[model samples]
Target: MFLADAGVPTVSWNLLADLQEMWAYPFMVNAFRAGAIVSVVCAVVGWFMVLRRQTFAGHTLSVAAFPGASLAILLGVSTSLGYFGFCVAAALLIAALGRKGRDAGAEESAVTGTVQAFALASGYLFISLYKGLLEGPTALLFGSFLGITTGQVTLLAIVGAVLLAVLALIGRPLLFATVDPEVAAGRGVPVRLLSTVFLVLLGAATAEASQITGTLLVFALMVIPAATAQQLTARPGRSLALAVLIGFASCWLGLIAAYYQPYPLGFFVTTIAFTGYVLAHLGRAVHDALGRSRPRGRTPLSIGGAA
Candidate 1:
């Protein structure tokens, strides 16, 4: 009868109304706030992580967070503390080992793999020690929206602020080092110190991002948006800003979709971000192909990221 009435709005209108109702709940409100914070933090740190080709390191840190949160459950301590502690510790270890490793690229992969394996083992051990309680680690691994509290939102904001500040202090030198470490070192930039500092920042960022995206889905928020933005632009400033926009949109939209649907938030977030990346890649490929017919030779891709 309600559907038959002329006064009744369409399904789209019902969806809009439901969205408003979604905000009425405190948990949903907190989830949105937390998602925004996580998106921004992940975008900034992740932009640099991708630029430096340290995606493996970032993945290792995310894996490391699993054990940290699990251990916290075992000890009945705050999971955030465990997350930050283990991630930072892993970052330091990776940094230290990278310096001593024979081939920089190959060693980074080996070290990251080793760390990831150990972390997963420790996580399983802790989860097993937790007796019959499964929800704590499950939330850390898969994410939970309704469990997000106002205090967690505030903490994410504060951590995000500190991370951004530190990045601002080191961004220029870090970028130079990332682009050409030997040249940056010749120009008097402390390449090694900056590498260590950046790794720590990456760890913190991974931990913060995991709160929203979960450890397994951290790449959705941290890498996919940043990578997509980089693919679309060579200018560093535009790329960073675009990454933040993409991440925020993905996170927010994912949250909204998860609210209305019966599926997982991480799945929606990953799907949305991945879809954007694939579209960008296809558009760029098509554009290049069309441009190539005008010239006898293939058009060259831009290798250097412009300031």
Candidate 2:
């Protein structure tokens, strides 16, 4: 068949040969799955991240994960495991430290920033301590989908499912807490605990995402989609759903572009995500303009973006 002739195996003989061939490879299949699962989790967690104004936490946990990854490489273990372990530890530390003060302000974030810097420096130092320590040592921090294995894909699936469940179980309470912490506390919503839980999940999500996009570009996976959706729709549920869709689209498209283009995969994904955010902003502007030129007291489509 055409697919076989084009070096791709497909159930349909007449399918696009080159594209089918790409999927015939296990590595490609694993990369696609891992990237997809991680993208969804990141998008979901990122919604709260934006609402709670905790993008800094996302950034903090990612860099703090570096030391664990570096140590994993030196100790002959999976970098993902190392990264997860380290971030969890840091999350616990942050929670404890932040709880000590009555007023949680820039001070907590400043401490997180300092920890992040220390972790990054430690990672670099560990890497430099040994020669030929890795095949592509930097890939742990920067990401390389080309290197994903089936086992890693399975691991991502498990982690993604667990994270999604946790997010769903606490979604409503978290939303309430994020929008109005004082009210949530007054209503006995365990505001502090909720905040800590969110931060922990965010750290885990960041570690998973960083494996594909690197620590530097994890924000694309975490922040951009939710942010774009918020700009387009004002409602929490709608924005969250749209953010997931946008994040998924960006992942698949970025993967394809990375497959074909010479640039790093993260670059393509980041560009697409940024573009989506921009378009959303523009769409908001147009909506405002049309509303202004309408009848008095016109009912605008509730920006809530939900059905």
Candidate 3:
């Protein structure tokens, strides 16, 4: 009966009802816009993250942001500010502690793990300090996209633009460093400074994406598209473009799906991103099977990040 009655009026009713309702809401518009911007930032930075094997860092930073967000909630302040604060602190800590490790990846993972535990504990303590006094921080942790405001959208736009610009300007040098740190240093590239700056930007993006997708799922944007792009290609520029496209497509599609379905948008968006990655990997496997597979030498170290 539902299918038999499905006509112009039926389709129009869904459009005019769910479609119109979501579009008519300002928060939805802001969340969608913010998500798009954050997706771009995440995609670009993610290329370097994967290249440098910093996905661990990205994940750690996302989890480390909890205490700051909780503290902000306790103080009745913007959770984004708290997230940024925590990320910056954690970023610096990771950079400092990982400076001399033979395995930067292992060191980073350790630091991130420590921060994650402490941040989670602190968040709970902060929540207890103000028991029953405010809205639950779980929404911030799990994301409250429908609660995004115009001010947040503007902030996301500004930060995202600046991050993208820096990535563009620093792309070549950053890549050089990531691929071969010894060679980059021999060529007088400020590898240390670049690494610090890159980590900071990654932190910022992590904070922003966390606000959109929540801490638990922020890695979907920060890691998935970039990882998918890497599986698809070894070329840097092409990978960046592909990752951005994938990220944006996932976000927009997920948003639309969430608008109609009775589920959280982040879950849908991450599922879409993960599916894209799986499909891309499968496609690449088919491609390799069809072609003569020559190793592209040792996989070059990434300057910024992808996968």
Identify the leading candidate in terms of TM-score.
Answer: 1
RMSD of 2: 6.3
Report lDDT (CA) for all predictions.
Answer: 0.88, 0.82, 0.82
Could you arrange the candidates by TM-score from highest to lowest? 1, 2, 3
Worst 10 residues of 3 by lDDT: 1-10
Instruction: Score candidate 2 by lDDT.
Output: 0.82
The model with the greater TM-score, 1 or 3, is 1
Q: What TM-score would every model get versus the actual structure? A: 0.90, 0.88, 0.86
- Which lDDT tens digits does candidate 2 get at residues 100-189? 245575767876777778778887887887576765555665667877888888888998899999989999999998787888888999
lDDT tens readout by residue for model 3, 1-307: 2112432122244555866766676877897899899999999998899998888789888887777788887899997789889988888887777644367667667777877788778877887897864656666566657778899889889989999999889989999999999889899999888998899889989988988888888888999999999999898889999999999998888888766565677898899999999999799888878765744544446523445
* Top-lDDT candidate index: 1
The residue pairs found clashing in candidate 3 are: 46-305, 46-306, 47-305, 47-306, 48-304, 48-305, 48-306, 49-304, 49-305, 50-306
Q: For model 1, give the 10-residue run with minimal summed lDDT.
A: 1-10
Error of 2 at 257 (Å): 0.8
Candidate 1 lDDT (Cα, 0 to 1): 0.88
